[model samples]
Target: MKEQNNTTLMTTTENYEDYKDTTFDYEHYEELCVKHDIRRFAEVFLPVFYSVAFILGVAGNSLVVAIYAYYKKMRTKTDVYLLNLAVADLLLLFTLPFWAVDASIGWKLGNAMCKITAALYTINFSSGMQFLACISLDRFFAVTKASSQQNFKKRCWAICIFVWTTSLMLSITDLYFSEVKEHNGKHACLPIYPKDSVKEVTALIQILEIVFCFVIPFLIMLFCYTAMAKVLLKTPNIKRSRSLKVLLTVVGVFLITQFPYNVTKLWRALDIIYGLITRCETSRTIDLMMQVTGSMALFHCCLNPLLYAYMGTTFKTYITKTVKRFSSWRKQRTESVEEYTMYSESHVEETSSFSI
Candidate 1:
């Protein structure tokens, strides 16, 4: 029995060696995942889920950008920030096709495209969060301060420039780090730093993003919204309950969507720094989990537009009108199709009877 077990172990080891030159053999890897399982539900979830998100996000955010650019024309700070937010979401959504393709098959795009796509993904994600915090700050000011319109415009422009510049600087590092890495005859667009600096740089960036992009921005939004809520609630004439509910809804959505993703990111960073999960299988598990959670974070871009629809009456009016027009057009098309079908059937009957 002991001799048979030893032989089986040797055969298994040899098979693993042979499998490396082949494709991503997930099934065989699962069998070998006794010590630690790298394969998760997300391997199946990502490709399909991200494709859906890409479609919805692109359609929704495009309409928002169009509204801002053509219909509204950026009359206020909110408009500018919302327009930038839509642009950022669009930027993030455009990268989803590359990722969806990569998740379904593998990274067929070469190194340069991989780097560019990854950079855009990270840049837009960072900027989107920054823009959220900016909008919150602008709302706080509008609620509390007596500001000249000119001053508000100047502040908004400065905020936009700062957010774009900072996020760009942060994402520039991805160009150096991201690469087309071949694994098991399948390519992955992975972050690849210098061999010596890889761990340090990766961990450092993750920590920085967690603090700046996630934690700090969240804290800012929390404080601003809380103060705004307080002032509005104290007012006798204000419809206190409705205003408070809207404020709570905004903060609640942010917490629910962003919190888990941020926590997962922080954990991955700590794992990198401390070697908490030392096994290769466990390391791959962390990588896959990050990808899934990061997609969740990106999904907030689409939902952000919905929150604006709920909050801004002007925006909601436009959205309702657009929705009505689309509904009417769809109804007309359905009626036309039914009419065409009936007419064709009658003509066919007349021709068949006469020919006989």
Candidate 2:
């Protein structure tokens, strides 16, 4: 019996070793995962991460859109760009429920849904980040040259169209690389590429995203913000208005919310390449760390709307009014319920006394 068990174990190990080279060898993955307890990690944390992401994401983006749509005066050129950002964020949030359900309930949603959801996810991520880059460049030019603002405003619509179109193309790339497959008696959408090519493609795309959408734009934003800060500081002769403070806060929040995510992404790309080439023994640990760090970037979808509230004056006012109205309604509902309960109790007491 012991000899037979040993033979079974050896056969399984040999099969797993051969299977790793295949694209959809989720069975092998599952074996390695069981040996290392990967599902335990997912079960413990994925639900919480996605729930927080969805709730905050939906609320924040909705509020931003509400404020922007409500106040016509808030539609400056900059605000229009922010409106686009808000729209992208909202679109992304709209898909979070699907992801949340998938994480909790398993992939009951079908191949069509898998592809559509994947497309939406990629499109939003690419479009949203690219829009951020465009906004950063616009700011850089506006600050660096007086005439550039006029040119930027004129070209803004064209730039937006380009960003969205490019994003749409990039997002649809998933349709080519990924497929729906059954695993562990459940369906999953996974990227199917040669082992080496899969790693290469992942690294290539991450590098492209970090370089074009993150590092370059961040540097531009850094320069603009630093220069702006210097001008604000040195110009002691000039009085800074509340509006100037507000504008600085807006730019500052953008840097704060986005910078860490970009830095982490760049580092993650390097880590992936390093792990692959060097066959680093620490690859597992690095991958785990990337998962945590990537969540920080994922949370940005939730943070974008908050930035609009902080930066846009009209949004602040509108949110305040909305919150007050909600509070008033809650109070009235509570009072009405209490009053009904008291009257019901008195009627019951009187009936009992009359019967006595």
Candidate 3:
């Protein structure tokens, strides 16, 4: 019995030693799992999409800013909001190139630039959405309660200030938590909240962003545009159909561009909080969807000027007049140059004849 007990003890000890030697290989396990090649997709897709968006967005928003500044066209509260919206769109567009590079080749711009760029992106994105809401509200008031014009006009600057301040405050998270980190042997610039609170903080920020940037603005636009559409329908004006179409286009475009992106963002936030995405393929699909949806959302900046132009009679008229004036100025300058050349040639000929 003693001999049997000693043999059993020796077998148990050997089994324990074997188990200790067979350590779990996390990296090898990860390797065995099917890797999602997101970097390849991002490298091919993001730079081209971002480039087009940046070029068109810059050109359109710059023209909007130039027309507003040159013509002094902030004649209404809606105009003020449109101008600020244009400015915010331009600022947001400015951050795309950095992101494009980051997506393609990784973030080489250092930690400070990462933070600044991230913060700027958040600020302008938030403010742009808010300004869209402001514009809708202003137009709603204009159509429904003309008597409220004086109050809105008086508060336009104040409201803009509030939007910008609110956007800035919301971006504090990016400014504080953004950093450059290596992922899969490539550097990325992203917010890395404290490990203890990362899930909670990320989820909270994502929810806040979706609410303020997308949900609230969408609700305001929906309400204001619906009311304005009803008012236009009842007014029996010549431009009523056109106005209704513009309102529909605005709301339609917003929904098409923003809705999917926000949905994906919300999903990501929920996943962070709940560890919802367990499969590697599902995670990769979500990443791809996020990239595609995000690019679509950014494309809205390019459409803003076009949407505003359709919506605003004043903007259309100003754009037409500006084009005509620019053409006339160029023609007159060309004619003047030709006349000066002729005069100089004639003078030279006279001087030569006199010398002869």
Kindly list the per-residue Cα lDDT of model 3 for residues 1-356, writing each as its tens digit. 00011111111111111122224432443444443366576677878898999999999999889888887556788788888999999998898888878766778989999888888888998899999999888888888986455566668999999999999999998889888876555677767677666668978988998999999999999999999988888997998888888899999999999998889888877866665665556756766777778778878989999997534667777788888998999888777666665678576664454311
C-alpha-based local distance difference test score of model 1? 0.69
Cα TM-score per model: 0.79, 0.71, 0.83
Off by over 4 Å in 2: 1-35, 137-154, 183-186, 194-199, 237-281, 324-356
Give per-residue CA lDDT, model 2, range 80-159, as digits (tens).
67777878877776766665455444566776776777677777766777666665555545554564344555577777
TM-score result, candidate 2:
0.71
Which one is best on lDDT? Answer: 3
Q: Rank the candidates by lDDT, best first.
A: 3, 1, 2
As a whole number from 0 to 100, the lDDT of residue 247 in candidate 3 is: 92
- The TM-score, computed over Cα atoms with residue i paired to residue i, of candidate 3 is 0.83
lDDT per residue for candidate 1 within 1-356, as digits (tens), equals: 10011111121111233223334553456465542122233335666777888889988889898777656767678888888999998998888777766654668889899788878877888888888898888889888986567767778888899999888888777777677765434566766566566557867887887776789889999999999988897788557888788788888988877787778677766754564553546645555555556666767887988886436788777778878888999888777665665678576664454311
The deviation in Å at residue 234 for candidate 2 is 2.6
User: For each candidate, how many residue pairs have backbone atoms clashing (under 3 Å)?
Assistant: 0, 0, 0
The 10-residue segment of model 2 with minimum total lDDT is 1-10
